[model samples]
Target: MSDAPGPDQAGPQTQLPDPPRPPLPPTAPERGGPRARLLGIAGLVLTVLFLPAGLVLSIAALVTGVRSRKRARRVLAPAPGAVAGIVLAVISLVLALSQITLYAIAWDDLNGYVTCRESALTIDDKKTCQDEYLPRIEHRFHLPKGSLRQDPSWP
Candidate 1:
């Protein structure tokens, strides 16, 4: 027999090289932008709890949330928390403004009442002035009736 193997005893077969694998898709730098979401939530909580500090925190949240959203858009990600933060900030600001306005009206009404009472010559005149003016002030300020009379010394 020749040195080469016979047909029945074939030599070892050659193995083919593996095909190249496709490159993986690029990953986002931020993992779902959780930092932005957290900041937004923190801002909303602060705004609700403390008005004075809330203004600053709310503004910061807005800025951070906007920046996060822009970055997320570039990566085609969602930013729902940022939108919520902005809405909450606006609501807190409105509440603060309304509270300030109410306090001012209350102060004005009290001052007016005191002035009216001081100008009266006697207890009957004071009573008459209070009866006439208190109702008008309450109506104008949308205060509950007898709100000014809660303290007898107010008259």
Candidate 2:
């Protein structure tokens, strides 16, 4: 028989399989749940309104957001709300820290001013101390002159 098959002699042709498809890219985590979203909103609002409360709320939100993100990541879903909450929490934390630092500096300056006045050797020296430090403290804190006061009750 001839090597080449005629129409009648030809058997059913075997089809080649298609090439394998590439794997899909990883998807973002799922959106955070209701509690997480609420916490994010609350945290952001408190951060703007009351710094101390905001700091606390921000910490709570960060914790909640991180947990929500972890849960979503396990399921391979998007967690946009959780991510936003985390970001807002970080900003709130930074603002709270800055305020705390400023307060500490102002307190230290006031204390130093009191010490300077008490340690002055004469009326002139006391006047010089006030003249030198009062302006600096006022300028730094944007306070009116002579706003700093020393109370005997305070240690």
lDDT of 2 by residue, 37-116 (tens): 56767767886788777778878878878887888879867676777778777777887788778778788777777898
Local accuracy by lDDT, each model: 0.67, 0.74
Global CA lDDT of candidate 2, please?
0.74
Error of 2 at 22 (Å): 35
For model 1, give the 10-residue run with minimal summed lDDT. 25-34
Tens-digit lDDT track of model 1 for 42-62: 655665677667667666666
Which candidate wins on lDDT?
Answer: 2
TM-score of each predicted structure versus truth: 0.46, 0.50
Off by over 4 Å in 1: 1-40, 107-140, 147-155
Consecutive 10-residue window with the lowest summed lDDT within model 2:
26-35
